[model samples]
Structures are given as C-alpha cells and as structure tokens.
Target: MSTPARRFDTDVLVVGAGPAGLAAALHARARGLRVAVLDPRVAPIDKACGEGLMPGALAGLRGLGVTVTGQPIAGIRYLASGSCAEARFRAGPGAGVRRTDLAAALSTAAQDRGVQVHRATAGPVTQDADGVTVAGIRARYLIAADGLHSPVRRGLGLDAPVRGAPRWGLRRHFPVAPWTDLVEVHWSRHAEAYVTPVGPGQVGVAVLSGVRGSFDDHLAAFASLADRLAGVPGTPVRGAGPLRQRARRRVAGRVLLVGDAAGYVDALTGEGIAVALAGAAAAVDCLARDRPQEYEAAWTAATRRYRWLTAGLLAASRVTPVRRALVPAASALPAVFGGVVDALAGHSDGGRTTSARTRWHHLEGAR
Candidate 1:
C-alpha cells in the first residue's frame, strides 16, 4: 500500500507571529482564504528595534484596521560632530511605538479578523507542488516571515551569503520625556544611536554598530545623548544581530518569504515595517491569484528603493570620513537630504507608484 498524502488544514500557513507574518495572515484572511499562523512566542512579542514607524508604515497598519497607540513623530533629525540636519515628513507624521505595543495591536487585529494563531514553533518545512507542511500542519502555501535569521528560509536552502562587516543593534527604554518630536539619529565614529519617543514618559534608544560591545559602551560614543539619559531608569537591553541578511530567492516550491526573511540590507533607514507590510500584502495577493512566481518580481519592485538606498548609506558609513561628515553634509545640502528622507519615507515616485492592489490587479489581468 502507498503512503497517504497529507491534507491541507488551512489555505495558508504563516510561519512566525511578528508583524510580517501576522500581516500576511490578515491579508490572506481578508481575501477569503483560510489562514493559520504559527510561532512559539506568546502574544505581544518584543524585539530590539528603533521603534519609529514611518508615515507609510503607519498608513499600512491603519489600512489593515490595526491601531497602534504611541507618540507622534514628525520628522528625522541627524546629529553628528556637533552638527544637526532635520527633515520633516511632507506626507504625514509617523509613530514611535514600542515593539510589544505594535505586536499586540497586530495580534488583536488578526484575532478580530478570525485569523487563527498557533503558539507553536514551525519545526520543519516540507513543500511540494500542491502544498507545504510544518509543525504537523499542512497548508496550500507557506509564508516565511520568521525574521532576520529565518529558519524556514534556511531550511529551504534559500539563504544567501552576505558580504562586508556584520552589524548589530541593541535597544533599551528610558523613563524620560522626549525632548523633540523628531526621531533622532545620533551618529558616532563606530556606531549610530536612534532615539524615538514611544510614550509620553518613555523613549527607546537603539544603537547600531559593526563592533560588538555593551549597550552602555555604544551609548558612550554619543556624549551629549548619554548625558541627557544619564541616571534615567531604563528597561533591560534587547538586541538583534548581523543586521544584514540575504535570501537567494524569496520563493521556494510552495513557500514564499516576507519581511526580513525575504532579505535585508540594513536598518539604517528605518524602513523595515513599511517594506515588510508591503511584502506581506504582495505575498497574499500573489497567493490569492495562484501566481506565486509573480511574488518574487513584485517584492523586488516594492523594495528596490529601500535596498539600494540603504545599501548605499551602509557602504558610506563604513568609511570613517564619510561617516563623520554625514550630518554636516546633510545640513549643507538640505534639498538632497530631504529628498533622501522622503524616498526612505515611501513618498518617492518609485517607492509609492505601485500599490499592492494595483499589483494584484496586474497579476489578475495577466492571468
């Protein structure tokens, strides 16, 4: 007798409960598809991040009927070597949300939409032409939003080698009122510190650097910022490492990768949430139309600006002189700086022209 074939329990199985996976689940459910999400962690997962949502990210969340409560961020401010350059968002203000708060909001929205959430790790991914299976659950398709070091992607043999020095991030929350509405980027010789207000009395500080050290060691590089936060009560440090991750391809058999799992250049531009949401929407759209192959091109188009711009800036930052002169250069050339900021904010023509709906329609028409 032949072995029995697995039956799909859900139309889509999303591996991971982070923003990307949850967003994919919600999108799939909205399209009338049965979706189930899996992750070992419980509700309201926390991670180390800058915690500043750009205008486009905020808009995407709102479109999903997810409301995140946090501080309103008006602009970006780059400070280095006693110089500062600021660029206010022209479209709208973003938000400074804590990771846990954002996760809770997404989770609540997913629950309200009737999307199933399973608190179990995806043990292994096995896929065929018909469907994929993981954690003993079978589904027509699998979305790997397992984040920077996604096991799903690795298991599928889609992991790509990343070149250059690896960078890491450390984040902590301080009990102090924000001094400015702008999300501050404090640049030092070997690291960059991001300060975003997550609440009326709470601010998050994340430091990114190629060199490994304690959070305090990284903070000490920014003398003025350290002084301001000195003696303030702070939450325990959280971290994520080797910020740059690459995938050989986003699709493998019946699986599609979204968010950081798809590929990541760096967090320097802070476009992670917006890009992840876009990728999630695109993945669901492609799956709904039975055109999973189209997802690769769509995701590439959606993240072109982020990948290029972030890669360029990251390369420049690796150089000592260029890193030291970044803020001063931006201050000197306000137009150029503002243009770059707007591009990263998802307001540029290349970044905003193709909406997820438009992509889906194009795919549908192609079919």
Candidate 2:
C-alpha cells in the first residue's frame, strides 16, 4: 500500500536550492518567516557560466549575507576581431568566483539561517488556495527557484512565455594560469568565448554560441587562449546545455520565480547573480505583505531591466561581418569598449546621476 501523505506547516516553501532558492529562503528566515527549500541537487549546483561577478551583482551579494573575496579586474578586455582595450571595473567592486563556489556559499548561508532544506531527486508539486504540497509536506507559501526548466512553473501553468534570442553555454577549466585579471571576451562570427581568471592558478572559459555541437569543438574557436589553458595543472573543461534567454512572467499566485527560472540572458552581461539576489529580496517583501501586485511589480522591474541590457549587448556583438573584426574594434576603442564593460561590471549608473530610470536607458543603448 502507498504511504499516507505527510503534513506540516511553514510560512514558505521554496523549490530548487540554487542561488535563487537559497537567497529566497535566507531572506524569508531573516524576516521571521519559517521557510524550507527543496531541490533535487544536494549542493554546489554547477552550470556553464562566465563566472565573473559584475559590480552591481557584488553589492547585491553583500545584502544577501554572502561575502565575495579577491581583487577586482581593472576593467573588461575585448578580443573580438583582434581588438584589445582594458576598461576599469565600473561598479564599486567585482570578483571572479566559480559557479560551484557561489552555490556552495549560498547553500551554507541558507542552512545557517535555520531554513529546512530537502534534497529530492524528483516529485510533484500540488497547490490550492490554502497552501502547496511538494512530495507531501504542506506550506502556506511556495516559490519556484528551480532553474530554467521549472516543474513548479509548469504545474502552475505559467509556462509558454519567453523572450529574446536563444543560445547555448559550454564551460571548462583550463589547467593553466589565467592570462589576465580582466575578463577576456573573444568574439567570433559563430560563437563568443569568455575567459575569466578565477585566481592565480586557474581560469574558467565559457563559449556562448548559436550553434549546436560538442563542447570540445566549441573550444577550438578560442585557440588564442591555448597557451594559457595549458598552464593550469588541474583545470577540467565542462559544458552547459541550451539556456532560454527570457521568460514571460516571474510571479504567479503563491508561486514566484527567481534566478534562471524567472528569466535568463546570455552570460555576456554578467548580471545573473545580481538580478537573482535582487529579485529574491523583493520576493521577501512581496511575500511579507502577501501582495500579488507588489510581487508582480518587483519581478517586472528586475527581469525587465536585465532583458533590456542583454538586448543591447547582443546587438553590439554583431557590428562586424567577420568575428576577427569585432575584437580589433573593441581593442581600439577603450572608452566606448570600457563603457560597455563598465555596464557589465555594474558601473552603468555612473554613481552621482545613476538612477533606475537612467540605468534602464543606459541598458537600452547596449541593444
């Protein structure tokens, strides 16, 4: 016979233990809400990401109770079409941390806050007006932090809405020293390769492209970094599947979406973490008042802002016919190039005059 359903009560139930879920749980617990998080993966959720922490994202992390270490890259370097320029980090601070390190840190922070965490391989999420039940436990609130393909979102019938272009991610660690502190983005006609120096001894590279093929094949495009990749003694190369660039809605009923679950953009902007943390913080406020309107407003503001920025970045990536042409142009124009880098590194607001309205406009220019 099947076991009877298990029952319990909590203020909020979070699905997926990635950055978004962890941030949501931590925020909820801080606000005196009893919270629990469930994810199939145990800890250190990994994905093929650029792994550079932009300035805006850094500020968001501090607010979420996570500490980022290391010196900031002076600015971003462009290697498309053989151009090169070093722009300074526009945001107050920036860092390069592996995706695994970030996820592990967030998980520890969530546990410290007294939120219950469950690692489930797979299960069904059923909800009604009173609460939501996952696997079996009941909760007064539910959140979908389950990455790009969210089962919670599907169950809630919130699927079918997406935005922007489509791309795939492939990642790997080179067993060599990082070529430079600055993030080196090598743009090609077919694919764009991002090189981030995680530290003195290692570098992580992510190739975002429109093509569908093997990870090893994509790495060939960055043959320029071959020497650097050769020096890292223990770096391992890995890859991530296709990522949807946008999502239609971020919040529905007791169910709210955060991180890649809510929406995602090409890693070119390096704004994913910042956006998720900001959204999670907003989610806490929305949940506190139990206001659907407030949650909608918050989600719209956060994702919409990032989407606008990514569109511009993608458009600029197509300035030249040959991939080689883009790099040289980037190297030649430091100010214009740095401005884009500053925007990615979170310096778009330019401090004194930077406001949400202004930031949105700057992001639009990138498109």
Candidate 3:
C-alpha cells in the first residue's frame, strides 16, 4: 500500500479570536486563503480597554466588513487641575464602543466571510518547513494573536520579558449621559483616567495607574471626575495588568505574531486597536507572499512611531512635576497639543512635522 500524503485542515490556523486574530482570519479569507480561528472562550468576549476607536481604526473595521455601533467622538481632551486642552479631530471622527460590542462585530464578520472559527483551546503549537500544527490541526501558517500573554509565542521561545515600571488598567461603566463628545484623559499625580462615551446614556471610564485599589479608590485621585459619579452606580470593574509586554521576534519559522502578542507598550494614547488592525493587514500580506521572515521588518515599520511616541509620553508622565504641568502646558499651546492628539488619532496631516526635542518644552512644564 502507498503511504498517504499529509494534509492541513485549513490553509491557516489562527490561534485567538480577539480583534487581531479575527481581523487576520477575515483578511486572509478575502485573499482566498482557508482560515481556521480558535479561541478558548466563546463569542462576544470582553477585555479591559479604553474602548475608544480612532477614525482610522473605525475605517479599518468597516473595510473588513465589520459593522459595530458606537458613539461618535469629535476629539480628545486632556484635563488636569482646572486647566484643559481640547483638540477637535481634523481627519474624521473616532468612536467609543463597548468591548463586547466590538467583539460581536468581529465574530460576525469572520463567520459571514466563511472563515472557520473553533471554540477550542490550542495546546502545543508545532511548526516546520511544510506547515504548522496546533493540537491535531495543521496549516501552512499560524498567527498567534493571543494577546499580552501569548501562549504560542512562549511555545516557540519568542516571548520576551517586558522591561518597564509596572502599570495596569481598570475600567468601569456608568449609566449616565455623556458630558462631552471628546474622549477625556484626566491626569492626576499617580494615574490617568480616560472617560469615553460608549452610548447616548452610558459612559466608560478607564484608569491607568500603578496604584492598587477599588474602582472608587482610583477615582478619588480625580475629584472632579469622582463628583460627576457621585451617587451613580457603576457596572463591575474590569482590569488588565502590567500594561507593557513584548515578544522576541514577530516570526518563528511558519508562525507569525500579530496584535498584542507581537509586542505592546502602555495604553497611554488609546491607539492599540488601530495599530493591531494595520498589523493584521501586513501579516496577511506577508503570509500570501510566503515570506514570513520579511514580517519582522514590516511589523517594525508599522509600529515604530507608536512605540516611540507612547514610550516618550509615558516616561514624561512618570516625573511628578512634569505630570502636574502636562495639561496646563498643552492648554496654553492648543495648536501644538492638537498636533500630538491628531497624530495619535491616526491622522497624518494633523501631526507634528518637527522633532521631539523641538517640542519638549511645550509638553514638559506649564508651571
């Protein structure tokens, strides 16, 4: 009897069905690749996030055919003490949506695209010159979009230790009408609180800090924000931790890392979703060309500015005096502040054209 030929269950095995994973699968399918997505959890997954989508991010989702409802965000607002700087978006409008709502949209898109999504846990990823295997299924390629702590990256020895001061994110929802159309970042001594309206009658607040406490405790740092929520009940708090994470390399043989699994810094600017969607496009293109190794360079260019800008901003916030003056200084220079906010919102034409050193004083101290 002749030996049987080996076969892969799908052309690509996607481990993780989060936004990145789902985006990768959908994009791959659009290119006529057979894709299989697996996530241990069921649909409509929820994670702690700012849940504010920049205009580019919203455009990316619609381009992928994922339609999710959200409240329009006109701009960004930085508040501290009694001073605040406001920047109206010049490119387009971003939106604030609940994580569960975004998850549902992604899941529906993947299913509608005829992509195979499995609700099974992936264990022991193995890859070779021919194909990659997870559990018993095999495919020509694998995308490890398993988030901050990616198990597939660990399995392939690509996990890198994150080096930075520890920071975490905690978020809760209040059933109140939105006070503003812009996403608000209220800076305090040791924390940054983000308030975004997810619906006409619902607002989400996420706190990024190194402090440990209840949601109310974190809110105490911002008296004005706390006063707004006085006597108002909130949903259960959701949390994500040690915000910084890293991976050794984006590629390991036939496997490619996408999304947070690839690497991440603190969520200071609320650009995670936009960057991840862009990475998915690059990743799927690389896979199509049978050039997995080239993905490392692609990944770098896709995220170079984000990593640089976020790191620089986070570093500045760590200094006590600098944190105190950030909002006030930005308030004085509305044009300069608007440029930075526009850059973060994914609008190229609205960002700074000068070097970081040139604007250091503008962002360093208002006192």
**Best-fitting candidate, measured by lDDT?**
1
**Ranked by TM-score, top first:** 1, 3, 2
Q: What's the lDDT for residue 186 in model 2?
A: 73
Best-matching candidate per TM-score: 1
lDDT (CA) per prediction: 0.87, 0.69, 0.85
Q: Which residue segments of model 1 deviate by more than 4 Å?
A: 1-7, 347-367
Measured on C-alpha atoms, candidate 3 has an lDDT of 0.85
lDDT of 2 at 130: 61
- The residue-by-residue lDDT of candidate 1 on 147-187, one tens digit each, is 99999999888999999999999999999999999999999
Residue 260 error for model 3, in Å? Answer: 0.5
Q: Count the backbone clashes (under 3 Å) in each candidate.
A: 0, 26, 0
Q: What is the lDDT of candidate 2?
A: 0.69
The runs of at least 3 residues in candidate 2 whose Cα sits more than 4 Å from the true structure, single-residue gaps closed, are 1-8, 70-72, 161-165, 230-236, 316-329, 347-367
Which 10-residue window of candidate 1 scores lowest in summed lDDT? 347-356
Model 3 regions more than 4 Å off: 1-6, 347-367
